[model samples]
Target: MDPSEVEFLGEKQLVSIVPNFSFGIIHLISGSVGPFRAGLPVKVPIWLAISLKQQQKCRIIAQEWMDIEKLNDSIEAEKRSKLFTKMPSNHFMDEAQMLLMVAPDDIPDADNIRTAVKDIWDLRMSKLRSSVIGFVKNAGTYAKLDHLTAMEINSIRSLLPDALDIMLHMEHGGKPTVLQSLNTTM
Candidate 1:
């Protein structure tokens, strides 16, 4: 019979006799060799065999994939976060570090991460100072008296001027906000 004249029957016709024969072929060949280039009669079959072999190799390699390195990197990141305080490392250094970590590819982006860190640090410091001041203010009449002896009153009054200077500096240093008003208008 001529090759072109041969017809492969569909699988459904043989369901009762050989249910698993869902595929059919006229001629099948397999081999481990070949350039099987165009203009060669055997090229098509050879190329199909090579493709099947490569696909099987890929499946085997994929099965051995591991995530150990990713796990280790995640653990290291957690440790670093714990060791470092979230406060900005002074203003300029903080900005430099944030820019390095989050380099802009395009667009005029503000360093939001740095801004957030500074804001949180400022809030925490404000709360702490307020608490300290409140405690000292409520301690007693002795807390306000200048009769506490020369050395003690000098130490207390010295802290007062520095605290006042910081409050004044913060008031004029940035965008106007309600918090700044609380500190400055007092």
Candidate 2:
């Protein structure tokens, strides 16, 4: 999914790149970037790296944690944990997809990244499904879900309203649920 603008822009990453040409330092609100040199590595923001890569000015080194090995470890750790574990980044898959699209050759094991990402996504989805099932089984009107990403909330948005409507219908005698209302033919 294309993440919200705020999430995408707010993601700060250290991207290593080898510049094709030399240039003076570039200043940003975050910090001063680099006085670039040909064939020398420099760390720049992911946004700036994407821009420079698009312009054919640099070869981006993928984040260390973006590798297949690291991702496998992360997924395993998450699966072993009872609670929702922190992912490498909240919108990592989105960011990785974008960067790989622009500079596939520059990233190490670009081909495997997709497969690794998919595996991690599937595992997380399974966990999420279990959580939703648990939530439904619990006899409670309200519950707080902290530490979930915005994308996670959006995924369950449609289900929440219907579930709430059904809860209300169960509490109040003979009131139509949202599903019942939607099922009516005009």
Candidate 3:
């Protein structure tokens, strides 16, 4: 899936919001949100929270994982791990991007949080790239990618599958089908 699609999924994750207006439970196909009260925080989907924030009807509460200290810890852990480490949220990157972009004023340490998240992302991506290069060079039949987030997997979707296909063809004593296809075209 593309980044936007991943973000769409991420938006479904619940976030805290304190609405200025009271409202009854919002019945949605996915699930139901609470009967909102003015000035009292309630949990709602990120999309709805963002919408309300944009409309000046509510304040968005940042997720716990959005904290700079926690994020920095995660970054250091990721740097130490050889394999992909578990993320605080399945959609951490997208969630951070959306919330930070929409309600920077609402979340404390927004600038530093953004920087920390970027650092974690960059570190993970660097590891992923190195793994991919090693996998390709070693002609690996398959590789375990535990704890990879959807966005991370999608980043390599276009390249890895095709490379694996070519490698599989070559490994089975057949000429690379990709090269054969190109030769035929020429």
What candidate 2 gets wrong by more than 4 Å, as runs, is 1-7, 10-12, 29-31, 139-150, 157-186
Indicate the worst ten consecutive residues by lDDT in candidate 3: 170-179
Q: What TM-score against the true fold does each predicted structure earn? A: 0.21, 0.74, 0.91
TM-score for predicted model 1 compared with the true structure:
0.21
* lDDT assessment of candidate 2: 0.76
Error of 1 at 172 (Å): 38
Q: What are the C-alpha RMSDs, in order, of all predicted structures?
A: 29.7, 4.6, 2.7
Candidate lDDT scores, in order, read 0.32, 0.76, 0.90
Which rank order by lDDT, best down to worst?
3, 2, 1
lDDT of 1 by residue, 72-126 (tens): 3433442454222332122222222323233322112334434433444344445
Model 2 agreement with the true structure over 90-118: per-residue lDDT tens digits: 66666677678778998889888878877
Clashing pairs in 1: none
Model 1 error, position 39 (Å): 49
Question: What is the Å distance of residue 39 in model 2 from its true position?
Answer: 2.0
Candidate 3, residue 92: how far the Cα is off, in Å: 0.7
